[model samples]
Target: MEPLVRLHGITVRYDGRRNGGLVAITDVDLDIYQGEVVGIVGKSGSGKTTLLKVLAGLIRPVKGEVVFNNHKLNGNSFRVGVLFQSPLLLPWRTVIKNILLPIEVLGEDVSKYLSRALELIEKVGLKGFENSYPWELSGGMQQRVALCRALIHRPSLLLLDEPFSSLDAITREEMWMLLQDVISHEGCTTVLVTHDVREAVLLCDRVVVIGGKPGRVRAEVRVDFKRPRDLKLQYTKEFNDYVVMVRGLLGD
Candidate 1:
């Protein structure tokens, strides 16, 4: 099968005052398949986020090209839904309004996406709280709203950058299941950047490890766990084996 996105010899360098001599990542290559969850894990300063920015079209590499849908990705990035560590909801906007924020930014008809927003709200278990403000909801709930907001635009790809890292342990586990269910239902391809090796093993179909001063792909580990995996899988040796393997690749 053809890859949805492919990166060839991607290299990004910073030339500002503080980061003048830094090459964030060098010669990084990756392939993202349709409907597969790919996790990127690395140590601090390993350029995990830098690689993601390249995929997002936010950072143009100094060398090589990013191919999406068999076409070279230029300044115009393909539509992608991003869920960051912070929910970053607008203080004044209600839950439903927050979800529709992307549509508004794209200068689209808000009324046209009203139903879609509501549907996403319910899908994320925020149905009755749509009218409530972000301050009223818990951290997990706010992240749910953020997830809905990312999906409201119906983006071609979903990017997750340690989105659950801020939540409590129990809440993070709950969100893992919720995200898995939502991704299964939506059938959207995903790329996740996380520091947690366990998270990558549990949530991703394949894990890529980046290392070195100028980050590069060190190793790729494939997880063969079955769908709709729950927390119980964490106890099994198979799950831990995958986690251990990925950690080994990270050399941590």
Candidate 2:
């Protein structure tokens, strides 16, 4: 079967006209299959997030094509959902209203998606907090609201950029489990850009390592571990091996 999304020879450069410019990423190629969770791992400035933006159609590559479901992607024309490090929820909006923000922005019928919004809120364990404002919730709870917002439209692709990096270690682990469940339940193809190697190993079906001054794919490690992976898996020697391998690729 064809991949859900394909990036061919993607290259991104910043501020090229004045100076020679900085090359963010060069000749990066990738394919994301349906229902697969792919992680892009590297040190700071590895261009992981830039590659993600290219896929999301938020950044146009200097050279290369982004194809989604066979056709070349144009602008923000494809169905996609994005979550960032910060929950970035509107402070005044209630949880349910925040979750429904995308629907309203897309000019879709909010009434038609209300039921789905509620279902997602429940799925993310934010059921009773629907009426609560952002200020009333804890950081973790706020992130849960963000997750609900990302999934409300049932996007084909979910782009997560260090979504859990800001949380406490304990809360981040909890979110790992929560995100795993949500992705499995929603069956959305996801591309996650993170600095956390363990997070990549735990949540990704495959991890791609990008490295060097001009970031490029250094290695692609397939995670063959069974599903419903638990926190205990992180303690095992096998899991650490994967972590070590990715670290090695990053020149750590």
Candidate 3:
């Protein structure tokens, strides 16, 4: 199948004045197909986040091109959705109102997306909290609201940057399951940037290991485990082997 998104020869450089001339990433190439999840794993400053920013069109690469469905994205033209480690919800807005912000920003019909907002709230386990403010919810619930906001627009591609990094272990695991369910049902292509090797192995169809100072793809591993995988699968030898392999690629 043709790739839904492609990054070809991507390179990024920052002004030396800002961070003393940091070369964030260079010559990185990747392809993501419809309904597939790709994990980009790297250490701090490995340019994993930079690569994602380039792909999402949040930042322009110093070199190379990003192609989405055969069309070259000029300065982030794709229908992209992003989730950061923090939920980043507006403090004043209610849960439903928070989700509707995108529609308002895009100048789309609020009424048209209203039902979607409500449905996604419920889908992410936030049904009754529509009128609740961000401050009232627990960390996990807040993140659920954030997920709903990202999906409210029904984007073609979703970018996640260590989104569960802030939560406690039990909550993180719950969020992982919730995210997998949402993506599987929505059929949205996703790119997850995470340092958690086990999380990568659990959630991704393929894991792309990034190495070097100016990060590039060091290895790519395909995971053929069955769909709707559970925690028990993590104990299997195949899963452990893949984790060890990825860890090795990361120079662990």
Candidate 4:
């Protein structure tokens, strides 16, 4: 099948105050297929987020091209949903209203997506909290609202930057199941940037590791675990083997 998105020879550089331009990533290439989850795992400065930014159209690469749906990316031409580490929900907006914020920003008719928003609220286990404010919810609940908001637009691609990194260990594990459920049902192509090797192995169809001073694709690991994978799978030797391999790639 043709790739849903492809990054060809991607390179990003930032101007340093004293050290001239710093190259974040060099000649990085990747392809994401429809309805597949791919994870980018790397150290703090390995350009995982930079690669995601390029895919999100939030950053223009210093070199190379990004092709989405077989066409070159052109200034927000494609529909994309992004979730960062922080939920970033508006304090005043109710859960349902917050999910509808994207519709409002896009100048679309809110009534048209009202039903979809409500369904998503239910989908993310926030059915009863639709009218609740962000402050009324727990950290995990707020992130659930953020997840609903990201899917409210029915985006073709979902870009996640460490979306579950902020939660406690138990909550993060719970979120892994929740996220797996959501992605399975929604069937959107996803690109996730995370430092957690176990998270990558647990949730991704493939893992791309970036390393070195000027970050580049150090290794790519294909995960073949079955769907609806249980947390018990995490305790198995097979699962840990993948994690250990990815950790090695990250130089952990």
Candidate 5:
């Protein structure tokens, strides 16, 4: 099967205060298949987010090519839904309005997307709070709204960077389940960039481990777990084994 998105020879560098530039990533190649979750895991300053930014077309690689559905990413209107560490919701916008924010930005018909926005709110279990402001919701609830906002446009790809890191352990677990359900329902291919080895092993079909100052793909682990996986699987030897393997690759 062909990849929905492909990155070949990806390399990024940042201009340091000194003359010489700092390389964030070097000579990385990646493939994201349709209807699969791919996790990129690494320690802080390991260039994980930099790689994700390359995938999102937010950062142009110093040397690489990004192909989305066989087309070059540049000069193309790529539809991607991104959820960051923070919910990043507008303080004044209501839940429904916030979900529709993407539509507004895209200059699409708001009325046409209202039903979809409401449907997403319900899907994420944010019903009856559609009119509530961001401040009114709990941290998890606000993230739920953010999830709704991300999927509002039915993006071809979903890019999540430390999305559940802000929540408590229990809330984070709950979100893992919720996200799995929503991704299955929406059939959205996802790329998750996280430092949590356990999270990657549990959630991704494949985990890519990155390391070094100018990060490069160190190892790739394929998870053959069945869909709709139970949280109980975490306690099983197989689950922990994958986690341990990924962690080992990161030199944890």
Candidate 6:
């Protein structure tokens, strides 16, 4: 199958005022297949988020190209949807209203997408709470609303940056399953940037380990385990081996 996204010789650098220098992520190349979940794992300042930003066209790479669906991505393209670490919901608006926010912003007919938004809210397990405000929902529920907002436009590519990082362990696992179900049903290409190795291994078809001062692809592990994978699979020796291998690669 042809890759939905391919990053070639990508490089990113950050210039902070106090410690201005080449801040990691150099010569990184990757390929993400359509309908596949690709997880990127690394420690803090490993440029994991930077790589996602580059792929999302939120920031331009100093070098190399990001090709999505066989075409080089331009900075202004709106073909992708992004869900940040935080829900960024409009506290003043209700959950359904927030989900419909994107359509309203695009100046499209919100009525056309209102049904779609409601469907996604239900899909993400936020069904009965549509009329509730963001403040009324728990952290996990808030993240569910965010996921619905990201998918309201039916974007071909979904960029998830630590979408469940803030949740508790049990809630995180629940959200992981929720996300897997969503991806499996929607068949959208996903690139997730997460710090949790276990989450990456459990949720993604392929795990890319990024490391070093100027970050690069240190390791790539394919999870051959069958789906629908659940919490039980995480305890198997094969899963443990992959976790250890990734941990060693991350130099943690």
TM-score of each: 0.97, 0.98, 0.97, 0.98, 0.98, 0.95
lDDT of 4 by residue, 121-220 (tens): 8888888898999999999999999998998999999999999999999999999999999999999999889999999999999999999889999999
Q: Write the per-residue lDDT of candidate 6 for residues 167-242, one digit (tens) a residue.
A: 8999998998999999888888899999999999999889999988888999898988788888888989999998
How well does candidate 1 score on lDDT at residue 24? 92
Q: What C-alpha lDDT values do all the predictions have?
A: 0.91, 0.93, 0.91, 0.93, 0.92, 0.88
Question: How many clashes in each structure?
Answer: 0, 0, 1, 0, 0, 1
Clashing residue pairs, backbone N/CA/C < 3 A, model 2: none
Tens-place lDDT digits, model 2, residues 9-58: 99998877777799999999999999999999999998988988898888
Q: How accurate is candidate 1 locally (lDDT)?
A: 0.91
Give the TM-score (vs. native) of candidate 5. Answer: 0.98
Poorly placed runs, candidate 1 (over 4 Å): none
lDDT of model number 6: 0.88
Clashes of 1: 0
**64-125, model 5: which lDDT tens digit per residue?**
89999898888436899999999999998998999999999999999999998888889889
The lDDT leader among the candidates is 4
lDDT of 2 at 52: 85
Query: Model 5: C-alpha RMSD to truth?
Result: 1.0
Q: Name the lDDT of candidate 4.
A: 0.93
lDDT of 1 by residue, 56-154 (tens): 888989998999999999765688999999999999999998899899899999999999888888888888998999999999999999999989988
